[model samples]
Target: MSGSEIVGDIAEGALLARAVEPAAGEAPDGHTQETACLNCGTTLCGSHCHSCGQAAHVHKTLAAFFHDLLHGVFHFEGKIWRTLPLLVWRPGLLTREYIDGRRASYVSPIALFLFVVFLTFALFNLAVGPIHVEPSAVIAAKSGGVQAEADAARELATTEARLARARRGAADRRSGKRTGVRS
Candidate 1:
């Protein structure tokens, strides 16, 4: 048979074998059996169980999905808090130290940067609301600069009107009530 036909035959054979031996350690949905903790052999409860710290997780479980989501979101599982102060005070000391290969002891700089960014965004959302904005835009929008400008224009108009009235009074004095000019 041709290579394509041979490959197709092999795939059919494998599918037949899978259908025949469905319970040979495969879940109905194709998931493999869950493994217990290596150290304690107890069925792990979740990612790092309370009993033996075994990660009782499969890639497809709802709980595992949520666990990963929460881990990504909160991010301070332990390392973020430890590294932040050092990052702020020491500056490139972190980048330098990490680059030197003394790695196993701290959060990765990328991870730390992500954590800070997530924290800043979370705090910003909590403080502001659903709407996203720059602080400068928000401040500029709230400030009364437009109203102030309008007030200034009104004031200029008022001053001009007052100056006109004063000029009219002076003209009346000059023409009608004249100071006697004896040449």
Candidate 2:
């Protein structure tokens, strides 16, 4: 593969990973539990134990892991769905709200990008209409955009061939030999 293709793959992988992962410090259970008591030795529960204000609970389960995973995905999807309509129409509202820390109400950028990419590719493949056009003036017009690139490539090849001939002639002159000439 080309360098750009490799780079693109890496970038795509990174973006997908970002979309799949949860943000840092975002509590899975929306609550933090304390490990130990300050005044007396007591097992903590729910932010505080009524006796002291300490954190509560910790994540420790396979179910909890999967739950957090689903939570992240659905949370992101929910935000995207809510923000997408307004984003498509207003545009400014989504940006402003996001900048103003209304992030909880909207999908993150990476998530939205991934979702959009996935949807676009899926829809494109599933689309049944005129996916392939018959060869005609319309098709020619569509291809005309690439005509200049083809012309440039032809010109480059011609120039390179001319340069090669010139180099060969120069080498013959330096060696005092006549090329392509009968004795």
Candidate 3:
């Protein structure tokens, strides 16, 4: 083909491609998709809404859900890196800085607290399994000999009586009849 005709064809192809491609912040369809804050109706430009602090985009996929969870739990990004030093060595300075509104560089106090608590509990659970105990052994250790046996018998009798009373009260309530019990 001649140079002029080739150029014309390329321009036409470019126009067609541009027409088919969606614009930024738009869905596949021709309509302009809302990247606005679902909570407050403000236009969103980043990961979170500027006006309401809500996430701009919510992921519907399971992989994205897990990615978010992992990111939240483990990813310190730049905030933790900036906050940790001051928090560990000069907490007063950190607090002062945060209170003075120089907060963009550091993690928020509540977020740091929650993350530390979560980390502590997660580590503790990993290090130590659920506690197990034998009820008879525990009771025997607390009490000794005939006294222990007598205490156990008394406790069993009391428990049985309480259970019987509870059952009677439930029955009365179900039957829509008033019993001697106040409730």
Candidate 4:
């Protein structure tokens, strides 16, 4: 760090302010200390490395990490908006278009299934927290009926069975329906 070298660095920083070419890894967004690609030795010309597709400035902060986690999950380059309606209303058309090599505009079927599965389990866990099995007598009393606890127990068993089947995975539900169709 001589004074002359400090002036040179200041001049380069000033170049960014002007209409001239900015330094490597210095985009309009943020300045990166990286001059060359971390993954490949190629000089970065943009926010993403031109040679390899890795981002020039990888965020190492905790906030950045969480932001990436959320963005990666939720933001599929705004393709979800194009994907969901077709998937729901015109599934055959969606599948045909995807298989016909027009996939970049929509989320792939496998990716949609995976995201739905993750969301389903996350929401199911949140909704079903801890299971509390109360005694049958309480249920009959709550109903204000004079029926025996045995009748209450049977009703509870039937309701529990329905809930158990409802909680099964999508594949399991489909298979169960197929089995029913076959029989």
Candidate 5:
């Protein structure tokens, strides 16, 4: 496929993302000591701001940052665990419940659809890799004859050396070494 088509496909997948919500007053462990929200200057009566709807706690630590990042990227804030089984066994009920506005308790239908689509693509990508091919004749046309053969031999040797070094590194890690063994 053309580069534009490939990019368009990726963009289609990218559009429906970022479903996971943060741990708010609605969710558990949303306690905040501060009296005012960091955003909008709203008086904090609860764990989240009423005016801007930002979390009042506003975690600054590295762990919380990663937690939020994971949640944001994968929608792993406990909704997928609840949504998927129901989507499989009782799809009609799940659809009805989502339409009836019981959406907060499960992943949204669109988000779940996008997740499953990308997951299928990921499994295929890992198993099969890139689908296109550049012909050997094209390579020979670019470099030609004896020089091409020498270049190919040199490239093969370099690749084999890298593979051997990687294997040695893997063996070192498996043997509980602090560092990889140098070639």
Candidate 6:
């Protein structure tokens, strides 16, 4: 048989199997099933709906949730492998291909962005511990308290005086006034 005919046969067989098998979300006790799509009321054929593409199985188990998380991070149908090189080295080409609708071969930009951001945050948190600020009391305890306060006050006054002089200089320049000092 030709390739197209073979594919058609497989599809027909799948549909027949779906018809014969118990629908999803059924308990198999001869009662009506709630397997109908919540989004569009179509019978789901597999894990996802053929009508609306929403997931047919909404897993409530913790194991299933972790499985989905790992699958999303690591599986992703090898699209990340294809997208990363173009994203890092040839971003313009990536943008062009996505804009031109040649997208089946690579991850979508939004998906890639989200994945990258998640990966970045995960790695950052793993590598760097949370920042802890030393309170002023702790800092004062470390440095001699009275001396540290006096030094900080002196530095602040010096900084304020410098800033005031700079502001006066700028105002003088803007008003086209010159100090009486010779060049």
The model with the greatest lDDT is: 3
Per-residue lDDT tens digits for candidate 1, residues 1-183, read 899999999899879976987654356644444556443456655654455453443334555546655655555466566567777898587667555433333565555657678889999889987885899997887677887898999999999999997787787786776544331
In model 4, the runs with Cα more than 4 Å from the true position are 1-75, 131-183
- Clashes in candidate 4: how many? 0
Model 4, span 1-183: residue lDDT tens: 999999999897767655454353355555445677765667878777787565667554456657655655676777899888988899899888755434446765656666889999889889987666678867867676655667889999999998876655445666664433222
Residue-pair clashes, model 2: 6
Model 3, residue 77: displacement in angstroms? 2.2
Instruction: Please give the range of 10 consecutive residues that has the lowest summed lDDT in model 1.
Output: 52-61
Q: What is the TM-score ranking, best to worst? A: 3, 6, 5, 4, 2, 1
Global Cα lDDT for candidate 1: 0.63
Report model 1's TM-score to 2 decimal places: 0.31
Regions more than 4 Å wrong, model 3: 1-75, 137-183
The CA lDDT of each predicted structure is: 0.63, 0.64, 0.72, 0.68, 0.69, 0.69
Q: How well is each residue in 1-183 modelled by candidate 3, as lDDT tens digits?
A: 999999999899868866876353255542334478655667879767787575656553456656655665565567898899999999999998766535456676766777989889889888997668899888887777778789899999999999998998998899999987776
Clashes of each: 1, 6, 0, 0, 0, 0
Pairs that collide, model 4: none
Alpha-carbon runs more than 4 Å astray in model 5: 1-74, 133-183
1 in model 3: Cα distance from truth in Å?
86
lDDT of 6 by residue, 77-116 (tens): 8678888899899999988875643555576555566688
Question: Global CA lDDT of candidate 5, please?
Answer: 0.69
Cα lDDT for residue 97, model 1? 58
The superposed Cα distance between candidate 3 and the true structure at residue 91, in angstroms, equals 0.6
Residue 111 lDDT in candidate 5: 61
Output the TM-score of candidate 5. 0.34
